[model samples]
Target chain A: MTGQSPIVYPGRMSRWEPQARERLVRAAVELFDEHGYDSTTVVQIAQRAGLTKSTFFRHFPDKREVLFAGQDVLCELLAGGIDAAPDEATPLSAVAAGLEAAAGNFTPELHAIGPALRAVVESNSDLREREALKHHSFADAMTLALRRRGIADPAAGLAAWLGVLAFTDAYACWIDPACDQELTALLRLKLRELRAAISSLD
Target chain B: MTGQSPIVYPGRMSRWEPQARERLVRAAVELFDEHGYDSTTVVQIAQRAGLTKSTFFRHFPDKREVLFAGQDVLCELLAGGIDAAPDEATPLSAVAAGLEAAAGNFTPELHAIGPALRAVVESNSDLREREALKHHSFADAMTLALRRRGIADPAAGLAAWLGVLAFTDAYACWIDPACDQELTALLRLKLRELRAAISSLD
Candidate 1:
């Protein structure tokens, strides 16, 4: 799936060489695919992007983090969505709102790179561990957000975990070549299915 | 607290020194608490245990792993518990069984080490990430076990996540010196509370 054309985002990214972060991401993903993740170096990514090694270090601490850019932004989006939800809404409804808030991040550009990112991450144990921790990050962010909205203890935590699960499952489905549904729709469906599945647990 | 008395295990562990793995774990915990996890070296841990560095390596791959021993064994215990449950048991019931099975490892010695382990892990980011991945591992093992029992998708996965949440919450409570309940009882209570919270989600 790695191609020569600059990956473009509809809302924010530019035509060819976007912002520094985009350029770095594009360069890193391409290099990771072509040279193998382990073989690709930060210097090479920087060189491919016409940026200095120091600039690369400024954007990301390490090469493994290049693919995981915007983690904090995604967490902010999830929490912000919940924060903006109506006071009268239920906890899961707020969580659904959080999911919807995070929907903006699932651009077709991210779709284009999903397979390559998945391949690179799954091939390495350290990357897999990082990905798992990412799930925890999302859950923790959403849980704290829910608690702030007056949802208490295990209920808030439970709803947040459900949100993370739905988002993770839907993101996987969206990355699959056979899936036609939008990420938002898939997220809603997955959340509903999980809610339904709760009764089946008994 | 790390003490002069040999940590005793009622079911399996010996009074002092115990097995090589236990000895390594004890030595590592002591060293970690005294020197801080970042400052502690594998050689120091080995030396503290009156063993060579190679013997320590034989028991654990790294210093960080000494505290996380028996992960596979716990996974197996969880799966085996689910396997031994009656076929007619509900998914949560089977999960409760799994938690009960894993409870054998929670000797008073582990409880004694709980606060110290928490302090060491919380003081470091790497340990926190590894700790998060451990939760993922337990959830995965339980998910696969539930699926083997003919539980369906989303249901199996959801149930497994609930089991993980319950186990994690109960673990925290069990570690609290103020709490008097048994881990098994705590697990059951936490599971029920989460199950009840699911309905509130809607």
Candidate 2:
């Protein structure tokens, strides 16, 4: 029987030299695209990054963690945003703000990595489950934030899940050259449409 | 690389052996519960059913498929329900009808297998991704059904996703004895609450 990996504290330490970490992620992402996800080994990724296998192990406990670099930071920012929203904003607005705050990390370089991210997510079952778990975590965090604000009949979990899906779908559409809409504007439109669609269900 | 399992054609088989199939499923479910999903093998399951490993494979391609036996059939039924729903019914209502039809497969005996099903989904990333993919397929099926019914908007995809999530959440609540609500009634309440939540976003 295969043993479950020990749980490491996520994003806790600056485990590797910054340059080495960046190189590892870049090389892994590129290799994931070129050779495919299951075929790309940790050794290959480390070698491509010009680092020893030991250094790669030092930075990431496993293969999947490399693909999800910076997720912990994103979650922390989302938590903060949800907590800091002013009294005037609706629950959905607070969630939107939190997501917007997190969106700053989707830099030009990260955006260029979109197809690779989707490919890895699509190919690996574990990656998809981890992604779903992350989404659930964000929803749980949002629910707690909403509960703190005393909003009765908490739909925070459902709302958070829907909002994330909307953002993801809209982001995918916006980034396509054929879509002809900027990401920022498209996200706003998507949010508005999602709100409307939800309203229609009522 | 592992070869894909051969697709079994139903026409080549004799008249449906419901009793044997049911016995096999019962034995598999019991084994899955006692030993956990990964630890249970085809040989053990077959012995429990008083059948052979060859017979078990003849019925199901693998262990995971045993848990997902009704998924395709349910997807088809839900898709058909959506297609046949009255034009005056709201999109939510249509989706709800489809969900009810899908959930119709949940017999009293099947409820006993809930823990094992959830365990399989939780422990295996590949299984989890396949679940997501199955949901995606059902959503696409619903979208096509809605489009044929003359729904006009970018809301088709979003609505299908939300509808499925509502069904899923309600189903989870239903199987938990601690929840103490009838599945049908709980589903109705969930859809109503979901509608209210969606409308509030406006």
Candidate 3:
């Protein structure tokens, strides 16, 4: 929760980090696929991305972060959206708004690279763990926001977990080659389905 | 999920692993508190536990594995419990049964050293990631078990995540100085409370 979070804020990405981050991720994944994950180096990724090693670290904490580049900004958007949700909104709507906010961070490049990134991630256990950590971070960010909204212990945490499931499902759809829906619409639908499924579990 | 999981099975612990594991954890935490996590060595931990270095490795995959001993066994119990739940049991009950299976791994020695282990874990980020991974592993274990029980994608994953939150809450209480209930009881109550709170979220 402390060391792992959004390294930069919203609008900060407008300052040049986003394009650099994208290049780094694309370069890192290319290196991973071509040279094997273990054989690839940050220096190589930076060289490939046409950025310095320091610039690579400036955008990503490590090489594994290549596929997970937009996470920090995504997390910040989640909390910010939740925080900015209208007064008297239910937790579900608040989370949905957060998802909508996060949807803005999903670029056409991210969507285009999704399949390849998934392939590279699925090929490695370390990358998978980092992926899990990323989802966990999203939940943590949402949980904190929900708590701030006066949602109590199990409920805030539960809603946050549900938000993560929704986010995961929506991302899965958004990445599919056949899917045409925007992430915002998919997230709202997935979250609504989660809300419905909550009652079905009993 | 593969590289980071319970290293041993249930009855497998009968053959000198549990005692060795306990000794190793106690020793490791002691060393972590005294010499700091970076300064501690596997050989030194083995020395403090009065066992060979290989014996320490036999019980744990790495130094970080020391604080998270018995996780593999707990995961097995979770899956086993879910598998053994009655044919008509609801997913909630099935998860409860899984948690009940996991409760057997919480030894008095674990309870006694809970605070120290937690303190040691809280002191470091890498260890915290390891701890988070351990919880994520538990959810993975349960999700697989629920899938075996005919539960579908988002439902299985969501149910497993709820079980984790309850397990987390129950563990928090179990580690408290004032908590006297069995982990099984605490887990059941927590899970039931989660069920009730699910509807309250909206």
Weakest 10 consecutive residues, lDDT, candidate 1 chain B?
Answer: B9-18
Candidate 1 C-alpha lDDT tens digits along B26-90: 78888899989988999998888887676676567899888789788999999999989999999
Residue A112 error, candidate 2, Å: 1.6
Model 1 ranges with Cα > 4 A deviation: A1-18, B1-18
Error in Å for residue B75 of model 3: 1.3
- Per-residue lDDT, model 3, residue B75, is 94
Models ranked on TM-score: 1, 3, 2
For candidate 3, what is the DockQ-based docking class? medium
| DockQ of the candidate models in sequence | 0.71, 0.34, 0.53
The residue ranges of model 2 lying beyond 4 angstroms of the native Cα positions read A1-16, A123-134, A152-154, A177-182, B1-24, B119-137, B178-181
- At residue B157, give the lDDT of candidate 3: 83
lDDT by residue for model 2 (B110-170), tens = 6766766776677776677567656666777777777777775556666676677777778
Most DockQ-accurate candidate: 1
Candidate 1 TM-score versus the reference: 0.90
Provide the TM-score of the second chain in candidate 2.
0.84
Q: Could you tell me every candidate's TM-score relative to the true structure?
A: 0.90, 0.82, 0.89
Per-residue lDDT of candidate 3, residues A139-197 (tens digit): 99999999999988888889888999899899999999999999999998898888877
- RMSD after CA superposition, every candidate: 6.6, 5.7, 6.4
